[model samples]
Target: MKKTAQIFAGIRTPFYYYDMEILENTARQVKELAEKYRIDVHYATKANEDARIVSLLSEVGFGVDCVSGDEVKLALGCGVPVSKIMFAGVGKSDEEIFEAGIAGIGAINVESVQELYIVNAIAAKYGFVANVCVRVNPNIDAHTFRYVTSGLNTNKFGVSESEFPELVEMLAQCNNVKFRGLHFHIASQIKDIAKVTKTLCGVANRAVEWFAGHGFETEIINLGGGLGVNYENPYGDTFPDFEGWFKAIDENIVRKPGMTIHVEPGRALVAQCGDLITKVLFVKETEVKSFVVVDAGMNNLVRPAFYGAFHLIENLSAEERPSLPSNRVYDVVGPVCESSDTFGKGRQLPLTVRGDLMVVHSAGAYGQAMSMRYTLRPIAQVVYSDRINEAEKETPIL
Candidate 1:
């Protein structure tokens, strides 16, 4: 911890610090475990679209799972093979669909029958056959936050099972569209292994039989990744139980011969490899409580304000000065004008002061990707730990 603080003392505050080594290790483990089951893992581009991160994953041979046209272009720009890209989104624009069709990417997960028609039209215009996967809403409760849950019937994602007949008829009518497989994503941040596996098995089994009965042979079944990471204790569970999760899926999902399983993992792969570093500006004590104001705001890392998310906070300076009494509680907050800019309330830490550095763990995934310019706060710069060692100059906190 002391060495970590020393490393950050030279770095600018309110910047994203990524440990590339950890990222590579996590990817390697996930890749190994996924290969053990012969499953294809696609790194969801929405998580952390940092060029270095994207380039590294592409070089490592992980498929890119894109949610938008820009993300598709980012993967392509990062040199990810078109055959290793899978595009999925609810409200894809006509232009986006046309772009995907023209790129001749691996597969596009069609959300609705209308989207199927649109994609087919674009593909026919280009004189190409567009391979598509049907994103089905299994309607299973992912038992996660409502904001992150995506598989419910009420959610604006995936085509429901009730629309299967219509979807089949629409596919049959579209000559330029080829049905490749089915995609099911219950939600994000799913922790209950049994719950997700059970729901997925039931859905995959029915989907296989449904396709078979319709005289369509399914080649791939994409079980969209929702495996949660340890936010409360990122270090303790930096790398999620990928082996266990894969084993559970293997034991549960009955697969047909030559069928391939694909997973789109976003948060699980990158969440633990990064931290949000900020500097304390003031420690204000009021009649009700004490607030440790930091330079980073909700615009920098909004999980706390957006989803009431909890991240492990560490006082780096306090750790260095071990002589200070450690029994102090403060509300770690940001300088955003919004009242909800608080990161954590009643956070107990060693006695801290202004100029001290604070580290917010488990911010690698959505932290920088969701940043905003609200309040005109500067967007945090991202620095890789591996590169910091090469540059010896101190970076002033902006």
Candidate 2:
């Protein structure tokens, strides 16, 4: 961080700084663990679709898990093989289905029985057989945020257990759609391993057996990724518990012969490697509260305003002033118009002043991907740690 801080000193603020070393280390760890457990790991493209990140993960032997036609095309353009791409979503348009069919990529995870017929019709029109996997609602609470929980019966993400018979009958009729296996995605930011090993795996195992009994052979079991990262302490234990996660699956999941286990991890692979670097614009002191306003707004990073998520905030410039007391508390806010544009309230830090650099840690997952031009704020630019010297030469110091 000290070395990277020097680079940030010269560059403009309100940009995303990616630590390549951290990303590479995390990716290598995930790959090693996945290979050890004989699991097919797919990089969830929705996490951070930066071409460089996607290309790096693809080079590291991770497949791409896409939730849209554009993502599918993006994966293919990034040198990911067609056989390694998986398309999944609840509401896919006819045009998107046609794109996937024409691409002839890997399995399309069918969320509804109706989608199965649509995929079949699209494949038939395109003169190709579409491989599909039934996305089942395991009815297991992921113990995460309500907005991200998908495996519950109340969630509109996957087909419920009661709909399995109809789904099977529909699958039997869709000649252009070949049943590949079952897919289950519980939620995002799931910290409990028991939820996966004790609850999710059991539900999936029984579902696989039930399908087999109905004369439908299961070939792939895609346990969708919701592995959480340490948000409170980004620097400490920067990597997720990939070893424990794979071990749990290895010990608990019951896979049939010739079956493959797949995981679609998004945040776990890229979250820790990124930080939203912004400049402190003003230091406002009211009778009731103190606010450290920044140049970046909710348009730059919305996790705090949107999901009420937490990210470790650090005042980078204050590190150089050792004499300054590090005991002040203030609310860190952005320049956006909305009251919810606040990043962190009651944040403890050193005496932060105007022109100081501040960073929101662990923002690689949905940070840039979910950014918008709301209020016409310009999107943040990206800077890589490996190319800092070049950036220093080109970027004008503010």
The lDDT of model 2 is: 0.89
In model 1, where do residues sit more than 4 Å from their true spots?
Answer: 1-3, 389-398
The TM-score obtained by model 1 is 0.96
* Model 1 lDDT tens row, 117-171: 9999989988988889999998999889999999999999999989999999898
Candidate 2 has its poorest 10 consecutive residues by lDDT at 389-398
- In model 2, residue pairs whose N, Cα or C atoms come closer than 3 Å (at least 3 residues apart or on different chains), thus clashing, are none
Give the poorly placed runs of model 2, Cα more than 4 Å off: 1-4, 390-398
Report lDDT (CA) for all predictions.
0.88, 0.89
Residue pairs with clashing backbones, model 1: none
